[model samples]
Target: MSTGLAELHEKARAALDPVHYDYYAGGVGDEVVLAENEAAFRRLALLPRVLRGTPTRDLAVDLPGGRLDLPVLIAPTAFHRLAHPEGEVATARAAAAARTVLVSGMASTVAIADVVTAARSVDRDASVWFQLYLQPDEDVTACLVERAERAGCTALVVTADSPVFGRHRRDAEHGFHDLPSGLAAENMRDLPGGPPGGVRDIVMSPSVSWEHLDRLREATALPLWLKGVLHPRDAELAVGHGVAGIVVSNHGG
Candidate 1:
């Protein structure tokens, strides 16, 4: 059996298809950020004190929507079906069993309703947040948000910085764009009052600004959390919009 994440990653690389494996394993150009992520862990100095506490401890933490089983949360990543056959549905079920929150990606392979149903099948208190990708059309964005609400999502996580997708050399080399059959982004495939052919062609508004946040705030009652913030100035802007929280990141910058 795999003893740690490193071992698990190796096993997954051997088990998963090359297209999916590359997508998950590869980072942006030069992968400096990935290197830094590992270096940051190495830089941490653990200071264990004598008689501080017992081995057992409470891991729960209160989030905006509710209490999380642990302080950790699963980041929103696309195409869960690439990793498992059940896709985001299986992820939702696992999150329910763990009593933690799972932020379902907007580009999830499973439908939002199906993910919610899977989580509900295990526990009523399952906390699922929606990672929303705002489109150029307010109507389209609102429709997505409304569907999340109907599907019992507790919060809305807007990926504020990924207005444009980054170029990944690994993905290009592996020809991931060709896409295998049955791997479409199901959440984008269906939206309330949305047009046909899904949103694969939709470009995120490069003009997205604070005013857009105001419009998005009006669109949903769920607590809004902005992800992909890089600078303190941007964090201030998010706070000005009255966002519930800000996830500070440059998205592999």
Candidate 2:
């Protein structure tokens, strides 16, 4: 029997071209961490409990200042148009229907405001978080945080991974650095004169640093979180920097 996740994977594979799928699924270096990410989950085997006297089970979880009917949260992905024409809007609607939070990717094709609107269309009180990619320019990064707050995003997720672009040999083999013109990086384009250089320079944000985290916190009132942290010391440092949360990720590793 196919699980819901398996069905979605099949659908995604069928709907997306090989290049797009590889771009979304591929990871940096040897992809050891990427494989470990799935392997780690499988390591834990759930031990089912015996039947108990219960009429119903409540799945609702109270988070920060909001309540989630489900424990699931949507992970951010770039160029969602590669998966479906509706892009992040479609995923946002699905997340809202499930009463789960949706994290909007910094490289999303749909504008942040539009994604928030899509969530509101499904659930008036949808919980939405905006993922941030630290840009080379401090001003640009600050502006993005401001825009996300204005869009009513509940939190700011600073993706600390991919300071530089990862080398995905699969994408390189197929000359897949380019995305379709209409599906450009919306959030990143909010930069003053737009991103520097040509298409290959997509992930070339060189000026991001720990100090910028302090600047980011000062720039917005939204709770800040550091994603892509793998080391315990990094997690402690994030806590020291006044970060509300830390996402332990290895960038598809």
Candidate 3:
């Protein structure tokens, strides 16, 4: 097993196909945000409360969906199958074993039900949240939400950024346009406008607005958390809109 992220990344780089590795490693534009995220972590300093006479402390914290043993959560990342055959199923089980949340991506190679099942098999109270980009088509969005709900997801993480797909130079140079044959975004199967077993491509729209979010809020009883809110004004809007939580992210640059 890898001892640290650098070692893990080196192992992954050695094991994965070059094109697939680049697709997973690279980020949008010049990748400034990705560098900054790394820098931020490096700058993190945990100051110990010296001389405190506490015998023990609990790290568990309760969020809208479930209680987490640690504050850290596994954020949504697409196409886990590109890295391993077990894909998100393996990830879900690991997250459950860690006693934290796994925000499963909408673009996961494993279906949401299977992902949740894998997690629950490890820890019965494991929480799996669904992360999605709201489609321009309301029916499609609703259908996706219903799928998450049916799959036993505890929360919905709405990724509000990426009105358009980012320009990943590495992917473009490597010609990584689609998944390898046999692997697909499993949760996208049988969406609104498609035939039986037909998967609808996820569409990003510049026209998506707060009104779309309002409609979504009315549609589901699950806790709704907004991701990709970097601006303070947008964060304020999210709070006013009854969001259970806000994840201020720059999509890892």
Candidate 4:
């Protein structure tokens, strides 16, 4: 890790509860992918143009969803309240201030509308995309898409990597299975097959396929982005399915 990031990680470790820290830091299985991700990033070299001194440089970009003042974006991460009290709300605010996209997680501790409101409080034109995993129950999946639409998300980020939960050895060792008291995934409340005020658990299934993506595309007018596609064939398939974009990711691997 870079010196700055290492310092930040150390601070987070020092401040957060052990279980929560492990939940945030640990990846699936023995975390070989995690090590490799860092290794891969280190090997990359950005060759800057030399001898053409400009007064200022612009890093802005325009995507189908919205214009970004910087090329950087804040990708989705789940259950942020465990890390800080303000959680996704604070994250939204920061992203707004930076004039970049904040792909709010489906498993956010705060509700989607509240997160969007928080971002708008900083910049009215701020773009906040919703990140979701397709549920086995189509009704539940549709409900999530509706929620995102109602909350004013500019685009939908469908995470296609996690067909099933990966085995995080650290989490298993630390016995970190559930959120602490009073902190639930707020977006899951009042879902199908639950009490009026109950929250349903998010489900993952290997049965999810391109047909499901097709249905989702038909359901929402918002730009749809497919996340966690690493295979070239899968990328081609995504294009065939008419996704607005493909986020090349390995689900943090």
lDDT of each: 0.82, 0.81, 0.94, 0.93
Candidates 1 and 4, the one with greater lDDT: 4
List TM-score per model, in order: 0.91, 0.89, 0.97, 0.96
Error of model 1, residue 138, in angstroms = 1.0
Q: Give a tens-digit lDDT track for model 2, residues 94-200.
A: 98999989999888888899999999999999988999887776667777888898998999888997777778877887798777776677776646655453222
RMSD of 4: 1.7
**What does each candidate score in C-alpha RMSD?**
2.2, 2.8, 1.1, 1.7
lDDT for residue 120 in candidate 4, whole number 0-100: 97
Candidate 3 Cα misplacement greater than 4 A, ranges: none
Q: Please write out the lDDT profile of model 4 over residues 1-253, one tens digit for every residue.
A: 5478678879899999999988888889889999999899879887889877788889999987888999889999999999989999999999999999999999999999999999999999999999999998999999989999999999999999999999999999988889889999999999887789888999989999999999999999999999999999999999999999999989886
Task: Score candidate 2 by TM-score against the native.
Answer: 0.89
Q: Give the C-alpha lDDT of model 2.
A: 0.81
Using lDDT as the measure, name the better of candidate 2 and candidate 3. Answer: 3
Candidates by TM-score, descending order: 3, 4, 1, 2
* Superposition error at 235 for model 2 (Å): 1.2
Question: What are the per-model numbers of colliding residue pairs?
Answer: 0, 3, 0, 0
